[model samples]
Target: MNTLYFAYPGELETPTGGYGYDRKIIAGLEDLGWQVELVPLGAGFPFPAAETLSQAQTVLEGLPAGAQLVVDGLAFGVMPEAASLACGRLDLVALVHHPLCRETGLSEDEASGLFESERNALGHARHVIVTSHATATQVADLFGVAEERITIVLPGTEKQDFAARGSSGKLKLLSVGTVVRRKGYDLLFAALDGLRECDWHLDIVGGLDADPGCHAALLQQLSGLGLTDRVTFKGAVAPQDLSGFYRQADVFVLASRYEGYGMAYTEALAHGLPVIGSGGGAVADTLPDGAAIYCGTEDTGKLRSALKLLMTNESKRLDMSAAARRAAEALPDWRDAAAQFAVALGGVRR
Candidate 1:
């Protein structure tokens, strides 16, 4: 079998959409008859300590010549210098969910360094794959890369039977992702606060992965909003349990400030639940025209209005639920994504 090197700084335990994306892609590649070896750079990760950096350098040096290497953008975005060294030695391709430059809450120096590094690293790649057109545009504008050089591969969602909407049951408001400030859980809490008069249960499904401090702060904020009773923080649900949560919910709400690609929304839609999401980045493009009420910002009034509109009107929710399923059906499976990716990589010499 032709070997493909899958390099990531974060280990298997990293709990985020990016980690999930890497695993899915690796699996898909293996199913498509490629020998995919997962090479982890250990815990220190993208912002590695001196030891982690040395270890990653050793891993890079040992890769066989002419082997196709796939790297996470996060692993390379911080250290452009390291990327240049990798590029000189390997046939590297980058799968960028979003640039680190676009990350929230970075010091000016840190952001500047990441921006430069990503640009350098992206330039060195044989192929630059992104999850959405929104990210492609951002990459072009920020890094001066032409749009044609970028490939858009939407993330795949697991298949599930869409549950029947029960009319007499308590409405479930669902949100899933890591507990991070960038995810805008704080805004979601504010939005849910406005819905206090309504009969609804909020299920915030996710755990802290990269940042524990932010997670604690978000929990405090949730408590301060007096939503502890109404909101259930089901920390780090396994893949098996995630399907059940989707099936149980009536409405799926994703209150992210922005996303490169919103996989949670796709999963909810697949389960036949009407989605309510913020209309930031690629959320509008990924979702069906009417599958969701896209709140353009974190405004409480708009979120409340959308919640009321989706929750109170049974027929509207039903229609949107159908639309959401249709959208999910239209999406290509991971197998298809892998086939397309293979075609792209086939152009490169063995």
Candidate 2:
């Protein structure tokens, strides 16, 4: 049997959302009768830069001739040596959540430079898979790669048991993902500031990653705005408990500036929770028409209006809730994702 290696240099069982995409892809591949090797590399901040690069190089060197290697774009993007090693290795491919270099809040010149480097690095792959068409277009445009060279595989939510449960006394609002600036927890706090009088509580479930300064700043902003009591931060809950949280939430919101693919948005819809996501990026792709309200940007007034409409109008909420559930049911499973992966890699070794 042919072997495939899925490489992610991080804690294998960590609950961080960043690692989920790679894990899911690996599982999908495995289910399709492929002999999969999951190679977990580093596990800390600053990510053992020099040592990891050397170790990754060693791992790539060890792959059998014609074996396929699937690298997480987040880790692979920085390791130029690993890219070189991959070039020599058999049939290298990449699964990019989004180009790391295209992240929000970077200066245009800096973004442009990083984009160029990422385009070149991604070009090294025999094939590229992105989570959304939004990301695919960005990569194709930036890298000048043909659409045929890339494939879009939307992330899938592992099916969860959704027992019938009544909502908590307060109108519960939930947001999951990293506590980073791009996740827009700050905008969420600002929106909460305006809805202080409403009988609602907000829960943010995500871990702090890469930047502790942003985490501290978020806490300070929450305190300064007097939202500390109303907004709860449950840092990294287990997967089993996540469904309970989703069940309790009356609505789910992703206040992100952008998403390569908003998996949480889909997960919320799967649980029958109406979503309020910003309009651009992958938000439109995730939320079906009328299943969620789409805000243009961070206008607290706009968010406030949407929140009031959803909260006060019970009929509208229930309508969107049904629509969301239907949308979730319509999504393709992981097997479909893997089939697409196989198609993309058809020209390369099996």
Among the numbered candidates, top TM-score falls to 1
lDDT of each: 0.79, 0.76
In model 2, residue pairs whose N, Cα or C atoms come closer than 3 Å (at least 3 residues apart or on different chains), thus clashing, are none
lDDT of 1 by residue, 1-350 (tens): 76788888766655567877787888888898999888776656456787887777678778877678888877866555556777766777788888787676678987887788788878877777888889888888898777767788778777677667868668888898887777787887887787777889988888766679888887788788888888887888776678888887889987887788888888888899998888467877876888878887666678778898877889999999888888888887788777777766666544
Q: What global local distance difference test value does model 1 have? A: 0.79
TM-score of 1: 0.95
**Candidate 1 local lDDT, residue 173:** 83
Q: What TM-score would candidate 2 get against the native?
A: 0.91
lDDT of 2: 0.76
Q: TM-scores of all models?
A: 0.95, 0.91
Least accurate stretch of 10 residues (summed lDDT) in model 1?
A: 341-350
**In model 2, what lDDT does residue 119 have?**
71
How badly does each model clash, as a count of residue pairs?
0, 0
